[model samples]
Target: MAGLELLSEQGFRLDGRRAGELRQLRARMGVFAQADGSAYLEQGNTKALAVVYGPHEVRGSRGKAGAAAGALVNCQYSLATFSTGERKRRPHGDRQGQELSLHLKQTFEAAILTQLYPRSQIDIYVQILQADGGNYCASVNAATLAVIDAGIPMRDYVCACSAGFIEDTPLADLNYVEETAGGPQLALALLPKSDQIALLEMNARLHEDHLERILQAASKACKDVHALLDQVVREHLQEVTALLGK
Candidate 1:
C-alpha cells in the first residue's frame, strides 16, 4: 500500500500479527463504583473506557422523547488529551469526536432493547486513553461488556473489527500504520451468534470482487473478538462470585 508498510518480508504485520489475528484484548467491567455501568478495555496499545448511566427520567428536554416504549440512548465519545501521539487541545467538542459519538449512539441503539425502559435515557460515555487505531471498535466492544455487566437487556453483544486491503490481500484488524496507508478500510460490527451486521462502514474505494473477502475477514475477526470478550466477562463474574463465596 502507498505510504504504508503493511506486511514485512518476514510475513508479519506492523504489529507482528499474522493475517486475520486481532490484538490482545483485555477488559474489565464495573471499573467505577459510581457509574451505573463502567468498563475499561485495552486492545494492544489502544485503550478505552466506557461509563453508562441512567435509564431514568429524561434530564434536559422532555420534548425530545421520540419513543414512549423504552429509553433514549445518548452517547458521547471523547479522546483524552494525551491519547494520541500528539496531544489534543480538547477532550471533546471536536468534529471527529462528535461524529464518533453519533456513530456510537446509533450502534448501541440497535443493540440495546430501548423499548423496555420508556421515557428514560441511557448515557454511554467513552473515553479513549490511547489511540493506535480502531478507537470506535474498541469503544463499542467495551461498552457492550459494560451494559451486560449492568444486567441490561440487549439483542446481542456488539463485536467490531477493522479490516484493510494491502497489496491486493485482505487483512483483518488493521493497526495504525496499515490504516494510514490509504487503502480501502472497512469497519464492521456484528452480532456473532445471529451473523447479523449492526454497523458496516468503509473508507476509500474497493472493488466489488474484494468486498466479500474483506467482509468475511472482518466477520471472522469480530467473532474472535466476541470470544475474547466472553472470556473477560466470565472471568469478571468468577471473581465476583468468589468474593461473594457463591
Candidate 2:
C-alpha cells in the first residue's frame, strides 16, 4: 500500500481485473501416467503441478499413526530451482518449503475427509514452476484437482485465493509486485458449496475492520476459481467419454 500502486484510478487492479476477479485459470488433470493422480494448473503466468500418490500403507514411521483412525495427508511443497527470478539452491527441505509443506498438509486434511481411508497415507506434491504470487493457493487448487483425478473421495473441492488490502481497498489475486509491496495479504481455502473456509492465513498488520473485506474478496476469488476448475474437469470428462466411444 505504501510504495505499491495496487489499483489504478479506474479501479482496475495491476492485472486489469476488478477487486474480486481471479487470474485466468487453465487446468488439466491426470497429466502423468506414473502417478496415481496428477494435475497441472496455470493461473496467469504462475504454473503449478500437483501429484497425488497412495492411500495405501504408510511409507515411513508406522509408529506415528497414534490411533488417529484416519489416513494421513502428507504434502511436500517445492519450488523448482529455476522457478523464481533468482535460482534457488535447493528444490525442497528449505525452511520456507518445509513450512509450506506442513501448511498444505493441514489445509488438505481439512477438506479430504481422510477418515475414509484408515491407516494409509495420501501424498500431495506441489511443484511451483513459476513464482508469481499466490503460489500456495495455486498449489492447493491444483492438488485438489489431482486428488479428484485420482478418484479420491472428499468432502468438497478445496479452492484457494489470495487477497491484499491496499490503500483502504481490497485487491483480489495478488501478483508478485503487489505481494512484495507490503500490504496485508490473506490467503484462503474454501469449500464453495458449503462456504466453509478450510484454511485462512494472513501476513502483515491489518486493521480488524478491514479483515472482513479482504476475506470477502478472497472468498469471491476462490469461488470463481472453483467454477473454472469445475469447467475444466467437466470438459476433460467429456473428452475421455468421447475417446472411449471412439
Candidate 3:
C-alpha cells in the first residue's frame, strides 16, 4: 500500500475495471451426474466447484444433536493446492479449512429451510479450483447453486461478494492484487429477496465513515451476483425441460 497505488488516476484498477464494478461471473449447475447436485462457478480468475449430497437419514454423533431441530447442514470448504501460485499442503486437512467450512455452514444455515428435513443430513462440499481473491465469495455462490440443483428449499438465493477500500473509493469484487494491497477488505453473503445478510467478514480497519460505503458496495455486488446466478438457474431449467419434453 505504501509503494503501490491500487487505483489508477484514470479511475481504473489493475484489472481495468472501474471501482464498484464486479468481475465477470460464469456458472453452471448439474456438473456431476453422480452427485445429487453440483455446480461450477468462475469469477474472474477464481473458480469454485460445489457438490451436494443427502437430505438422507442422519448419521454419526455430530448430526444427532441437531436431528431434532432441523436438517444437519454439514459443509467442507477446501482450497486446492494448485489453486494458488505458491503451492502449500492445502486447507482441507487444516484449521483454515475448518474455519471456512464453519463459515459456509453458518451462511447456509440461515438461508436454507432445514426444518422440513428433520433427522436428515445435507452435506455440501466446495473446493476452489483457482485463486485470484474472492475465494470465500465464489465458494458460497457455487455452493448455493449446488444446493438449489439438489432440490433443496431455501428462503432465498444466497449471493456473495467482496469489496475493498482504496483511495477514498469503495471497490467491488477485489482481485488478487487489490487484496494484497494491505487495505480494508470485506466479504459479504446476502439474501437478495429479503435484503438480509447471511455472513459478513472484514479484514483490516477503515474509517468508521467509510465502513457503510464499503458495505453498500459489497451488498450491491452481491445483488448483481444474484442476478447472474438466477439467470443461470433459469437457463438450466429450460434446458432440462426441453430434454424432458423430447
Task: State TM-scores per candidate.
Answer: 0.95, 0.95, 0.97
lDDT of 1 by residue, 1-246 (tens): 545567776668877798888999889988999988899999878899999887778777762567477788989999999888886498447998999899898899889999898888888999999999898899899899888877788998999999988877778878776777788999999999999888898988889999999999999999999999999989999999998995
TM-score computed on alpha carbons, candidate 3: 0.97
Pairwise TM-score winner, candidates 2 and 3? 3
Worst 10 contiguous positions by lDDT, candidate 1: 60-69
Q: Which run of 10 residues does model 2 get worst, by summed lDDT?
A: 59-68
* Local distance difference test, each candidate: 0.87, 0.88, 0.93
- What's model 2's TM-score? 0.95
Best by TM-score: 3
Q: Write the per-residue lDDT of candidate 2 for residues 121-223, one digit (tens) a residue.
A: 8889999999898999999999999999888888988999999987788888888888888868989999999998888898888888988899889998999
**Clash totals for all candidate models:** 3, 0, 0
Clashing pairs in 1: 70-115, 70-117, 70-118
> Which residue pairs of candidate 3 clash?
none
lDDT (tens digit, per residue) of candidate 3 on 46-165: 999999998988988776877878999999999888899996686345887898899999999999999999889999999999999999999999999999999999999999999998
- Per-candidate Cα RMSD to the true structure, in Å, reads 1.7, 1.7, 1.2
Which parts of model 2 are misplaced by more than 4 Å?
1-4
